[model samples]
Target chain A: MTRSFVLAGALTLALAATAACGGGEEPAAADGRGPITLTDTQSHEEASRKIIDAWNAAHPDEKVTLDIQPKDADSQRQRLINNAQTKSDAMDVIMLDAVWTAEFAANRWVDELPADMVKADELLAPTLETAKYRGKLYAMPWLTGTGLLYYRKDLVEKPPTTWAEMKETCEEVLPKQEGMSCYAGLLDKYEGLTVSFAEAVQSAGGTVVDDSGTPTLETDAAKAGLNFLVDGLKAGLIPEEGITFKEDEVKNALQSGKVLFARSWASLYGTANASDSPVAGKVDVAPIPGLNGPGSGVLGGANLAISAFSKNKATARDFLAFFTSREQTKTWATINSTPVAHTVLYDDPDLVAKYPYLPSLKEGIIKAKARPVAVKYGDVTAAIQNAVYPALTGETTPDQALSGLQQQLAGLLKQ
Target chain B: MRRGARWFAALMISPTLLVLALVVIYPLLSAARESMYVRGEGLDADGFVIEGERFVGLANYAGLVGERFVNAFANTTVFTLATVALETVLGVAMALVMHGVLRGRGLVRASILIPWAVPTAISGLMWRWVFQADGVANAIIGEKILWTTEGVQAKLAVIIADTWKTAPFVGLLVLAGLQIIPTMVYEAAKVDGASAWQTFWRITLPLVKPALVVAVLFRILDALAMFDLPFVMIGRGKFSVETLSALVWDEATQLRYGPAAAYGIVLVAYIAAIVFVFVRLLGADLLADARSRKGQA
Candidate 1:
């Protein structure tokens, strides 16, 4: 049915090719009385469709059509940036990765949200802060994510509280669980590696790059943090193949009962507990273990922003407001197990009943640190991944990797 | 009539020429221009751009002397050499088997082309799964090795995947060349009491040299621009498999347009120089043959 609708639309366009401009004016009024196109990363297409459906039902005159972008955050940002740079108004509303907010807002690619549109007091502060460039808000915080330690609840009576304990625990338990590894995470050389490394470094009480854009991976704490990975692989606590594992691979490994402990996003909990999962009802989530205790997690979320060149700014803003409202956010949390920016939803009796992880997720979001905010964050991420991945995979020593990271990040930050 | 034919031919080709100019030449020239100017923002906390613009001619190129660029360059060169060499040998061997008098020759030929038909991105994903710890690669090797973790293993995995998907393309090209080789040449060699090895090396090899040389040159270009396979098989930013194309893409996606353009210019220069050497070394005759064939066509 969707295919036929698309086909019919295409045929209409083909037949009206010469008369396109004649009919295009009525729907593109300046007062923003027409349909608004909202672009979202395809990861949560169903939830987005449901939200759009609800919004359309509420406002028949101002329909919101969903435009799904690539699942990869970088590609989604680049596509939006390209469109914005070219001054094309193809997308009125765009979903932005938290880290990309600074870049997009600084370039004036996205419009600053009206001050009244945001209730800072109602949202998780750190996640809300990601939508701001300098002091003004440019985006509306929507979905928020944080790293969680997933462990076999049946195998371990208590989740380890520190890296050392986790390692010792893994070593002790490997013999009991056949054909299974101790732990896995997003160790692949990409942004996920950066997130994983950030959690590790912060767990050891170190930082990769501070808010001032200074390279901070030169301390003992940082070295120890990085060594958690190197030593784990070397000690055979973490599988050697885990170095190549991304989010899905780690999830699959944990879900299939192949790994005892794994680190992944909060979004994976529902999937892990699904009936089809081999370890369903046998796995549990906790704060990612640090060198000493619960470590910091890298803040991951999507924010909604109106394109600067949007033809229907009013409708776009309205749609964004409705999409991230407290009611809609609660619905999202209940339906998709996604953590929304609204703090009220965390304490909502209904949402808490549906998602037991909400309280923990709130705690994670409160403490989660945003990745280094820079116009060149993409380059910074690449540099960190390039320098640190080798060591994580045991191809380079921790010292060498740290020094390389320091030098590369230093150079990148200088530019 | 001749003048009219020339005019019609010129008119026929002009649209294609215009399209090539718009899509290819225009971007190349604009990118070259962009390489000279840095964006407004330096690495500052506020991170604002377009407030001020500066011209820093060749500064971006000079900054490319870092370990990352060098590593990417080396990886690309090694990937090109390794994949091209393996593909050539394997391709020729397959072409030989397919050229032989076998009852299932057509089936064998069709089967060899299947891998080539798979999109590179899809093939890369398939190979990534195959290289996973408990994947088919480990099963076949009788040992578990993380194919995309260590430098050597990851690089080798990419090479193996590239060779698998592309060798058949080379084989088909060589097969086309083989088909054109008259049976009389082999018959004459057989009648003269030539051994199998002698016939293969003396008669068959030289005859297939032109096609193989062209194949290698094309493969060299293709392998150097390899982005999808390595980008997918082993995730990006790994020094072992990051190609120049990947570096350019990484830079471009970051909106470092000037540096990306610089990288693009550098890649074009590198590929052009390599192509020059390749054609001078082995493809001069192949080029001449192509020219004569074009004239005939």
Candidate 2:
């Protein structure tokens, strides 16, 4: 009887421990004052640290701390999600990928910002839209990016404006260059693939998802966009190794003088022209090619949001506004060579001289479309990658891939 | 007196029991509970996602019949079997080489262990560069095999990297077993006119079985839960290289807690079942050896 009593006591203790490990209770809000932390990826660490150091020097009582996350986009998103799920007060401010704004806002992990938090009118319209969820502003657009076609001007005097022209150029140029491949982009099975696929569909006059968050992959334009990639691979226009190229790989291919034409972010312009680059003087940028003309780019970049569980929400809000102010944005743009969200910077004379690609980049960003807005965005992208990758690899036809994606997305969005 | 002794023993072990209960048992129970419910979906009037989980019984498990799950499950099984089989053969050969090298033995041992000492994630990145489209691997082969893309080559790349990293561990364990075999056994065989091959087949193989079994068993468990190497080297969502752990991670990161937990439980069941079969076949010998040692004492 005594032994049994001991066992029962142990069992009860275990049960209590299990109960305690359940979801945490809603935390009481803290006053908007004190030292707070900002969680961001290491990609912007240098600029972020400089900004934070200046802010901390000015505001002694409310000094900001920077928590650097991994440079990988997927890893950064997962870390932010984990912090929110635990309802921790660790992350006061978060740098969210523009695509994640909807998911974060819909889940209430981030607080909706006031309409007048920043001079929203100064921000580019396409980028400004990425900061909203259901008509309410949930984040402040910090940096913006769009895809550009990088070409070796010496090899090809004129950049192609249409998909057919790109193919014809590749046919004419690749045979002359012994070691050079025609084109490259992000074709790996990850988030980059999703972006590349979306650009293709949009360029072909199709939408991956409509305004109502419904799958719209079953269209002639969508097939045409997919065929551009599939046929390119089949015809050896895109080298077999292109299937493994991510953002870094694509940039490296162009900088290393392996590819004649490459599709990558605007940031590649600065790096490709760096002094040590092999193709430094030979490189030039153009708008992404399309079925009929210059295609649209998918908007890519990060935004700043106030974590809902933060104790110093007021400080967080103030810091965000300070971070995105005209002066700070200029500092970030010049130092990091990053494309800022401010519209005026694109046309500034001195800034334009330093970065000549800004005009074309601004044009691409203006025409760029935001990725599909869904609360289950993680699942949605996975489904797209799952469907589109096989098609690119020759395992499935474009028709099958799109239909499969349509059915999978229908089930996901139905809930 | 016996009753007093029993109570004292229980008291002595209760702290360890409590710690285990808090860490292991608690998580297992929590995950089981989590698997039985689904998170509320869709947005509310204010565009915020609806909160709270609703109980759905085995619906999460039922959802595992999808193609992605099946592909992940198959990949996990194939990776475990292929890796374990290759590691055993390669590890044994390495052990023999390490055991026989009289010159520069220390150097040989340390160099062999370097791969195992490198962290899995770091080594994964190192190998990724080696397997790049224009990397050293292709340069040597003179064929541009895209090792990182979705194909049989991707699977082979992961297997080759995993074997290279972990075969040293198996070799180390086997070397310890090799050292423990008495010189007298070999002397006795020599006196009886045994060939080197005959002595090895008859004596060395039997003497090393226990350590070999334990090493293979550990490797089996480790391989069954493989994640880092494939994820870092080949990336996620690749149909050719996705494992069960990657699938669970993909789901959890996507905020589908219920399905992730269900996959976790399924993986646990899979590992447990394999271990049970393994012990039934080979672990019986280990227990018998332990029993004989105790009897001798």
TM-score of each: 0.89, 0.96
Minimal lDDT window, size 10, model 1 chain A:
A20-29
For residues A32-132, what per-residue lDDT tens digits would candidate 2 score against the true structure?
78899989887778988888988999999999999999977888888898898889999999999999998999888999899998687798988998888
- Which stretches in model 2 have alpha-carbon errors above 4 Å? A1-23, B289-297
Compared with the true structure, model 2 gives a TM-score of 0.96
Predicted complex 2: DockQ: 0.55
Off by over 4 Å in 1: A1-31, A164-175, A179-181, A209-220, A393-415, B1-13, B43-47, B51-53, B287-297
What lDDT score is found at residue A164 in candidate 2?
88
lDDT for A275 (candidate 1) = 92
Q: DockQ of all candidates, in order?
A: 0.23, 0.55
Top candidate (DockQ): 2
Error of 2 at B276 (Å): 1.5
Model 1, span A260-322: residue lDDT tens: 999998878888998988888998888788888888888998899988888889888888888
lDDT of 2 by residue, B1-297 (tens): 376676676767776777777778778988999999989567787777899989999999985899889999999999999999999888888888899899999999999999999999999999999999989999999998999988899999999999999999999998999999999999999999999999878998889888889999999999999999999999887878999999998888888899999999999999999999999998888679788997996
Pick by lDDT: which candidate is best? 2
